[model samples]
Target: MTANPLDDPFYYLNNFQRVLAWLSQRYADVLSSEEQRFIEDFSALPRGSQGLLVRMVMRKGLRFRHGKLNYGEIGDIGSAVAPLLALGWVDEQAPLGLVELFEVLLKAEILSCLGHLIEQPKARKTEWLQALEGHFSQPQTFRDWCPQLEDRLYSLTVMPLCDRLRLLFFGNLYQDWSEFVLADLGIFTYETVEFSAESRGLRSRQDVDACLFLHDCQQRFEAGEALEEVVAQVNGLTLDNPWLERRRGKLLFQIGQHGERIGDFALALCIYRDCTYPGARLRMIRVLERIGEYALALELGETAAQAPQNAAEAQALFRIVPRLRRKLGGPPVPRSLAREVERLDLHLPRIDPTLSVEYHVQAHLHDDAAPVHYVENSLINSLFGLLCWPAIFAPLPGAFFHPFQRGPVDLLNEDFHERRAELFAACFAELDDGRYRQTILRRYAEKWGVQSPFVFWGALSGELLEQALDCLPPEHLRHWFLRLLLDIKANRAGMPDLIQFWPQRKAYRMIEVKGPGDRLQDNQLRWLEFCHEHQMPVAVCYVQWAEQGA
Candidate 1:
């Protein structure tokens, strides 16, 4: 692959054109009247003009200095920018505020432009901004801001229009024009999944507007805007898309958490009461407890205890319910016994400060017959990813939206496993009859560096892969994979840190290590309990530093 693929001066332009063409083809109905007109008008421009426009759009901000806009392929910048100005897309005289003007100006230019205002010529540009903050509250065109400077500043007027087109193309604002350059340079290799008509992230123009509105609300919330109005607006915006609904829920959850941080229990309680995000109920209970609403906390906690959302909520409720009962002057709730996990205690001399606890444990336990690898969450996840590649990458409707996805759009959605039930069933069935080994081995060879949501290729070496295949039981893999399907968001993590494989005996034991002052986290505890219930070999190893114990 070429170094940049920007080797072709038309690379950025080509990527932009591809996005526009994609929108023209796939998102015709979703495009607004303005967006549609812009697309049509953009197609009619000269190649150089198109290239220049794209270069400007793809850059950081709306404003670009004419001298900085030079591209050898686009020829003269003035000629390229002329057609854009005629269409009012590029405005040479757009009103720029002091802050916006300061962004494009350098230290020397700032000195030249506003030398009289600066008390110190050698002061930093940031300091100069503070020194001249209130002096130029009014906005002005670039020429007026810097009368002595000869360069023209081009401000893109249709940035919002271009942003909508971009949002339509990539399904989100985070993935930008660089995706094309990345793909061209071979930095990323996405699986080629076939798309269906039902695969659009934003299905209709209304959906597009809703998505943009929700995104704006998120920006406002992050910017410390008034809570009530932003929260009300977010709640008011009705969404038909499940994906968009999830985004809304997540944003609301963030607001609720932010409210808690600011000591606004009332606001936090208000947000969490109706918020359907995963951990909102748990947060509501915590807030109730925080504000001395013990009865309310216990009531909700008891309800949640009856049917917890997931293991995470269940674990939290266990601790919360007991405390709430104790606080409410009720009879003491009997605590359930924690399952007995195999324990290993270490007090080895600190030979190296840089090494991790897992590393120390692995080094301490290594032998010719038994070898330990610090697999953590990677090994099992990678194995599952390799064996079930076909099932995971199945091109179902709404699973894949574009060519750039590492995994399905709905990978964490509740129906993710349900939709691919049959596909996953077939993948799991291979494990029962000894065919999975070859399937996994073959996939390991073929899909070595292909992007996968599960596979940690950097962590998984060939030797470890072979060792796992030989030693690990097929039945164990099935249990793990099935549990992963149950609630992928919750179950995928919390795996044991180290795995000691007895290659000779075809045996393995997973170890969860904890350094001094460390204890088992909820997820780690859940994994340990799950392993114990299933009769899988797992242990919790504790390390106490420089103690009297020998």
Candidate 2:
């Protein structure tokens, strides 16, 4: 019945405020007077204005489009920018000449789209400005612009490196440093790589406030800093806002991990006790066992065994607890615990039967046909990539231009939906005319490989795509496509294994393989139901033990 510390909003907000204050002092010499003033005046602004300012600074350009700014969540864009305008930081009525427009297009990375202008290099600045304005003013015309270049217009890369570093940190000042630390530990789930050598050493500010503070901590930790010193530093540092409050448990868990890495098992155990991280109990038990406290480990394991969050945790406890009990010369695991473990063991193996089924189906397929590559995750994502295109091409105003969709958590707003709706309708229209297939093929032909924070493009073979187009029923395609759009995150996984393709006949059939005792998962069942509804040619192939023996 213990209350969560993060339940109070101020828990993170207060910490973020403190970090900003620390940054102001820490980088006093490196930051300009204007930059320092901005930091000092940040907290004094209204919360909405504060957010808007952060958004503006994070954007690529010093000047944002007046038209796009009108639709953001921050009420009264003019009122929000009034303070910034008075500070002489922003130019509200900045003139957009031809040269400025050309630079903007180049920075936005959409210059390629204006090939005619590039070919006619002698085009006047006024002509360039007029062309740019004309392109962006019309929704239909602008929708054709390469979606990837949307955020190019908003980049601050033209700014001095130190200033860019300040903006990067300021935009993410409210984030939990522990989450970044955990990412370094490889425990945080991430879809893309954020930091690179090119990014790190670009600036000349030797004492630049570390843009990624947790990364800096990790480097120091690796250089043999004492566990207590690291802990003291972490305690002294404050960087979090409401968005990061939800990650407090992850932070605590990572701190415990830090202790464990330094061989401070006792310290790690103590930290785990206070950590609300998932699987903390198991982690604590492991630490106890490492310290030869077998009896204590068994006691903790038993409690964990009784109420695990999932089959995986239950299975871990089932395997580890009894072994510890036996090693400590204690009695066997209780009957209830043993049965529960056995049940989980039986079901857990069925959750992802792809590996098992891949081999079985591959062996059965013709040599000319490639067996199911088990890229259901990538195939659906590639299909829905267009949904994110408009956001990429002409990103919403303010801090909404996150190419990787990593920050500014409030991504979806009325404007976002409106744009998505337009894209969705246009996408479906293309689908009806069979242009969507061509687009997917063209995207593949262009070798638009997986770019982190953007769409994941699977290496879909031409043969497979061609066969799929020929064999997959239109009704089934529509059904699954609609379902995927409705819930991209949830629907992306658990697809059937083994798409056996016949190049000779231009045919393909999706096969969901199951071992003798395995059953379909909920997601798998959902896919099957949709296929059945559309009368798609899909089959469930059950491999019996006797058949395997043969």
For each candidate, what TM-score against the reference?
0.95, 0.39
Candidates' lDDT values, in order?
0.90, 0.54
List per-candidate RMSD values in Å: 2.2, 21.5
Off by over 4 Å in 1: 1-7, 133-137, 546-550
Considering summed lDDT, which 10 consecutive residues are worst modelled in model 2? 338-347
Instruction: Estimate, for each residue in 1-550, the C-alpha lDDT of model 1 and write its tens digit.
Output: 4366678889888788788888888889888889889989999999999999988888888889988877889999999999999999999889988788889999999989999989999988888999898898789999999989999999998888888888887788888878887788778888888877877899998889999999899999989899989999999998888889999999999999999999988999999999988899999999999999999999999999999988889989999999999998989988989878899998876667799888988899998789999999999999999999998999887777778889988898878888998999999999999999999988988988889999999998989999999999999999999988888888999999999999989999999999988988888888998998889999889986654344
Give the clash count for each candidate: 0, 9
In candidate 2, what are the lDDT values of residues 443-531, reduced to their tens digit? 55653543323345444567656666665555556666666554444565777766666655756667777766788776776677566
TM-score of 1: 0.95
Poorest 10 consecutive residues by lDDT, candidate 1? 541-550
